[model samples]
Every structure is written in C-alpha cells, then in structure tokens.
Target: MNAPAPLEIIAMAFSLTTLRVDGSPTPALCVDDRYWALADIAPEVLQPEPSRGLMNVFGHWEHSEPLLVAAAERLASAPPLPAPHSLEDVLTPLQYPRKLVLTGANYYDHMRGDAGHSDWDKESKAPLFFLKPPTTTLVGPGRTVRYPEQTAKLDYEIELALVIGRKARHLTLADAMDHVAGYTVAVDLSARDWQRDPRHLVKFDLFGGKVFDDSCPLGPGIVPARYVDHDDLRLRFWLNGELKQDAHTRDMIWSIPEQLVAITEHLTLEPGDIVSTGTPAGVGLATGQWMCPGDLMEAEITGLGRLTVEITK
Candidate 1:
C-alpha cells in the first residue's frame, strides 16, 4: 500500500467564558457564529511537521507562544470571547452530526490482569462498544461540564477521535484509513459508579455513565488525518494541572485499520460519523480520584489539539 498523503492542518476554535490561565468565567461564542473561526496560524509561525495528536500544534512553544501569551494577557486584561447568542439560538444553526461509535478497552495494557481482560476477550470475540448522542457534544472550550445527579463518580478519559470523511461500509483494513477526514481531541467523560452497576452488567452499563449531556468535549481544533502519524501518537490527560494518564497510540491492541474493519462489518460509517478510539488507563476512577464539581480536566493528543473543561455543580 502507498503512504497516505500529508494533510493540511485545519484550524478550529472554541469560544469560552474562562481562560485556562484564570478561573473567571467569560462569554462563550455560539457554535453557529462565524466569528469563532480562527486562522491556522501554527504553520506560518512554526515550521510544519506531520505529527499525530495535539502536540503537533501545542508542542511548538515558539509558535504557540503568541497565542498562549495573547490568551493569558487577555485573561489578565481583556474580556472573554463574546457570547452573542442564547444556547437555543446558537444550537439552531449548528449542524449536529449523527451516530458516534466508541471502542472500549482497545488498549492492550488496559486489558491486562483483571476483569477487563475477560471483557476484552468478549470484545475481541465481539468488540465491546457504545453510542453517544450528538446532542452530547460540547464543541467549544471554557464550557462547564455539569455533574449529573445520576453520577457522583465522574471520570475523564482522553482518546484520539476520528471524523469520518465519507461513507464507508464493509471496508477492509487496507482501505480503512482512506475514510478518515481528520482528528481531534475527545474527552470521554465516564461515570464509574453508574457504569459499574453489577445489576445491569458491564455491557449495559457501558452507555449508562457515558451518554450524558456534554459528556463528549471535542475540538479547539481539528487536524486533518494526513498530518497525523496515527500509528505512534502520544496522548495525555491532566487534572488540575497534574499529570494522570499517558500513553502512545501505537499501544492500541486493535489498530485503527483493524478497528475500522471491525466496526464496518455490520454498520455503515457515514460522513460526519465519529469514532473515539479507546483511551489508556489512569482515569480518575482507576486512580481513586473521581472528578467533583469545580475540577478542571485537560486533554491533549500529539497531532490533534488541546481540550480543557471545567466541572460544575
């Protein structure tokens, strides 16, 4: 097979009320507002390189220096991004995509030495999965993740999310990568207490804790697939500025190619369909640190981009 062509890094921006540097809330831009669009300034400022994950953008201290400092200065001085429309007003023009399929426990190390192994066995035999409603999407930054009354043990999982470029069904591993349009940072917020209910069993509990409103916080930017080296990108997560989860994409037991093949066997993956590859271990629950109201969660992938959210009561 030939090497895939290099992808141009696409710029995506999120409007938020608060800046990561400061905790004060600012106005969030509406999803439909075109003012949210920002220039892909990373290239002109920094030397271009094809690296997968958020680091592809944030890794360049020199290039990102301007934006980061500008944001910081704004936080210290200027007002926040304008929230021009009401929530309902903004959601109206926003095109909500359909169908988001997530792969569970796709990392090899995560399935090692526990009930997770048995779960992996079942999944490998018949890949464990779940669906997230599009309405759950929080497209921009500075948005507060509300602590659902249904769950007290909210957790964060940072995973590389792929956006399908075209319709695909029954595709072979060899042709799988061709269907991906771009990549972004996805935080799969899991409610451990609700998800681990023995009464429902693991399979049914998969969606219980994970499918809440604003559970999936994506974007800030979307890097086209051509720019990412999917086989070996690094992913990391932090809570309140402390490192928690860290792993390489190459560690996935089931590669993207294999995952695409497995998923398409029964269902068609259409354009705008999203696939969140599994996250590595070290989540809040796994570490005995559950997310509470007022906690900050930040996630980053090497080539994709950084995504941060605040948990609210």
Candidate 2:
C-alpha cells in the first residue's frame, strides 16, 4: 500500500443518506478541486455501503490516499462531469469514534475564562483533558443539537480534531504526527451553566456539564493529514451567521505534537480515536450570550472543512 500523492480527498455516499442528493447516497470525490462520482470513475476500486462504511476509504493506512489520487486523475481527463454534490448530500465519512478526548484551555485566549483558574495568563507544564461518551456525543453536520434543559447556558467551541489511524502508546513528540490518520472539524458544545455550577453535589461538574447527548458535533468529511498545512491554519466559529471566534492553530500553548505526547504517555490511543485540540476565545459565556433553540452554529478550520449544526431543545 502506498500513500496517495498530496491531494485533499473527501467521501460521498452511494447508498441512502439523511439528505438524498440523487435519491440515494452520491458516491463522489472532491479532488484537484473538482467532484467526480466514484461509481462513474472508479467502480472497480470500491463500492459504498453503510456496513463497509468509510473505514475502508479513510482508515486504511496505505491505500486510502493512493486510491483517491488515482480516481482524481481519471476524473481530470474524463469528459464533461456532473456537478459535485454538496457536503450535506452525504453522511460523515467516519461516523462515531471509539474515544472522544477533549483538551481544556490549551489556547491562551481561552484560558482567561476557564473556570477557577488563577494562572489563566501563564502556560501550564502539561496538557489537561476530559473524556466524552463517543456514541452519544459524536455526530456529523446538518444534525440538530438537542439543547439540554438542565442548563440555560449552552456554548460552542470550535477545535481542530485529530483522527488517530494506528495504535499509539508512549509516543514521543517527534514521532506523534506519524500516528495521525487525518484532520476534521469538531464542535465542543457545552452547557456552561451546568459545567461551572458550584452547587452541584459532584466535585467535577465539568463531566456532567460537557457530556450531554449530541454534545460533540464532528465532521464535514476528513482531510487526510498529508494534505493539511498545520503551521498556521485558521479556525473560526459562527453563531447564527455571525462570526464569533477566530484564531490560528499556531497560538496554542501546547502544540499538537506535545498534546499527543502528553496524552499517549499513559493511555494507549486506538485507531479512530478523536482528540479535539481545544477552542479559542469568544465563547458565548464570555459575552453572556447563550445559545437558544434554533440557533445556527458553524465551526470551520483551514484544511478540514466547516461543520454546521443547529441548536434545538
């Protein structure tokens, strides 16, 4: 198996999807900045089915990229092509990850408002994180986030999500990138009021506050690690069509490599594990503007595309 030449690859459906583009999943590729249906161009390569899932296309260590590049080259020389289907036309390439690990206050700006932290302006010696139930929280774009009724303050955090391709344990910072499968966008939707509530009997209210159903919205397809320019990628979050949070990945206090090294130091991360690299400032809590039912939230990063989610009760 060989890696596909540097190209931004995407996944489309050939079977049924929530939003049917061609009355079924539209198996296609976004390559060389164009769209080509896999069936039309690479029927011999593979077929799309929910059971087979996108793992064959995305999780493959060596074949995923090469297969995409071949298909893209074929489409480039082909005759008039059909218009590419919108990302909304397909389901998330990989649906749910086995583990959803979230970083906390990894961003300098985000630390200012972090709960009960006196060293908000100073850098920490190590990374901090919390785990969310993957099956309940992991969802794709176009999905409605069920606003939990227990809290009135709902918030959103836009973070660059790392997808682990192979098993990683006791990894060093120098070798961390080798374990990354790809990059995708993720929203760390939170119930701030619940997360910070001091009155709760449980000492670690952060768990209860952040682990509600539909709390983690991940997707809009994954961009293979080979194609991402991580040096200074732009990250933005919009609320109700208004730009709210904007920052660069370079500003992170703990670089992605360091974060990975810190996490894998004790815990073994398996393939398909997703670690969202914390959000920047300008969360709703900062302005006392909480999310309400019917609010539209969009989280976007430079290489990985945008993930849009609607808020509902």
Candidate 3:
C-alpha cells in the first residue's frame, strides 16, 4: 500500500481516481503529482458500505469528501509510499458510471462551423442528449480504442464532462451546481459513415452513428467541483499529436446548469452519473477527413489533465 515518493507531487490540486493493479480495482487519492493507494493513505474511505473504488464513492461523496480532502492534505506531511503502479495503472476514474449521458450539439460554433445548423440559437432551442452503454463504451486514459469494422469515418470530439455527485431530480438553475461532484475530460469518438436505416427513413441515427465499442474515453481523473472553474476552462483535442479542436467551455450554446435542469426534470441524476457537455467546432465529419488505424488521440480539459488513447484496428 505504499505510495510514490513525495518528490513528485501535483502542487495545489488533488483528484480522486480508481486504479487497477494486479487486475483488481482499488480507489486511490492523487495529490502532490502522485497516485497514493487509498488503502495506504486512508483506509476509512474504503469501508465496505459504499463498496470499494470510485463508482460507489459518489453515492457517499457528501460524507466522504471531507475525509478524502483531509487525507490528501495530511499526506503531504506524512510519509509517501511508492506509487502502486505506474501511470498506466490508471483506469477510468469512475469504474462504473451509473449512466453515461451526453449532450449533443450544445455548442453554437460546433453547429455552425460544420455548416449543419449554423443558425442554432440558444433562446429558442433545447439541449439534445444521448447515452452510451457505460460498460462497453468507456475506456481509460492510455487505453486502445478499437476502430470498428462497421464504418469508414472515425473522428474525435473533445468535451468537458460534468460528474454528478448527488442524486437529484427537478433541479433548478439556481442551485444546480451544488449537485455537481466534479469535472473530467471526455473524448467522444464518432463514426460518420453510419448511414441511415433506410427502412425507417431516418436521416440521423444516434445509435448507428455514435454508439459503438470504445466510443467514449473518459478520465485521467476527476477534479473536484471546488478545485477549478468549470465554466471558463479550455478544451482541446488532438489527432495523432496534431491539435484539431480548440475551444472554451464558455462557448456552449446552453450553459451546464441549463442542460442539467432540463435533463433532471425528466429523469433522475444519480451518483456517478456522467453528464458530458457537448463538443466544440472541430470534428472531422465536415471535411471528409476520416481516421485510420494506428492514429492517436489526446483530449484535454484545463485542470483535469489530458488522457491519451491509441487507435488500432
């Protein structure tokens, strides 16, 4: 249970994450630029009540936050142990998101830039959302994303994803932020060639075009809600080390609060439910530039850190 040496520490920030070592998942607190196994730094947080790992921690977040934050703060003065595993041991911060929900076309520039919905207006429109099967779609940072055999068009959309810490429903704009657990970076991988299901005469099918194996890559780790300015942060995406998408969270067509309010009105937002804010103006669909095997993708959101995923056949 020893953590890495104290020489390398992430100054001024800490985030909670789940790591897989020896093929078993365990919760860890990352501070001072190091990942300290929770069992080593603090064992109380891992009580069986909430189950082990980050997934269940969300359900108990309100009560657990103080302990986690305090433990991270004290670790600096306490002895540091060797990191249980190297950075590659990092897994999706949320081992199992209860629901992986995302807002689509929530950015004005993204809509207009592609020339698809240039006239998209916030005052008159509602946010569009979709879901990906959590277990199959979410891969951790540095993991490999499979280029599905079904399509010729593959793309990346960098987005700032919001993690909900509290179970909420019918939330109002005024207090919506209170329910947020924290933030993380998400890469929405896409396949543009999923042609319409001709029998149904549907022009766009979310399932065919968006939902596929390894389509969503989330986390380097989750930065707590109080740790950073969620609305003003920057988002960037790179395809094979070339920056393609660059935008700010402030540019979204509808604010995060608005999206949360609308969605919560219809369904419950439970602990560990990920609500990904939409992507910005740099997807490859408009230019017909498709991704091929052996490509690499890096997605980053300021404060949350960057996650790298390799593309392979």
Give per-residue lDDT, candidate 2, residue 254: 85
Please name the candidate that would achieve the greatest TM-score relative to the true structure.
3
Q: Compose the digit string of candidate 2's lDDT tens values, residues 1-313.
A: 0233333333321111122346654435554345555556655434444334444444454555566656555654765335436545545545555778889888887776544355665443667888999878877666457888888888888998888878889999889999887788889988887787778886447776899988888876666676676657899999999999999998897888888898988798877688888888889878888898899998888856678888776
- For model 2, give the 10-residue run with minimal summed lDDT: 10-19
Q: List the residue pairs that clash in candidate 3.
A: 3-81, 3-82, 3-83, 4-81, 4-82, 4-83, 9-32, 9-33, 10-32, 10-33
Per-residue alpha-carbon lDDT of candidate 1 for residues 1-313, written as tens digits (9 for 90 to 100): 0124533122222221211212322212212232221122223322353221122222343344355324432332333344434322222111345777888877766666222454454343656678888766554455457788798788888888887766789999789998886677788888887788777854448768788887887765555465567887889999999998889998887888888898999899876577889888787655677888888888888755567777777
For each candidate in turn, give its C-alpha RMSD to the true structure in angstroms. 10.5, 5.0, 4.7
> Looking at candidate 1, what is the lDDT of residue 143?
49
The global C-alpha lDDT for each of the candidates, from Candidate 1 onward, is 0.62, 0.71, 0.80
Which pairs in model 2 have colliding backbones? 4-65, 4-66, 13-25, 15-25
Q: Flag regions of model 2 displaced more than 4 Å.
A: 1-28, 32-50, 77-88, 113-118, 121-124, 201-203
Which residue runs of candidate 1 sit more than 4 Å off their true CA positions? Answer: 1-94, 113-124, 137-139, 201-204
TM-score of each: 0.69, 0.82, 0.91
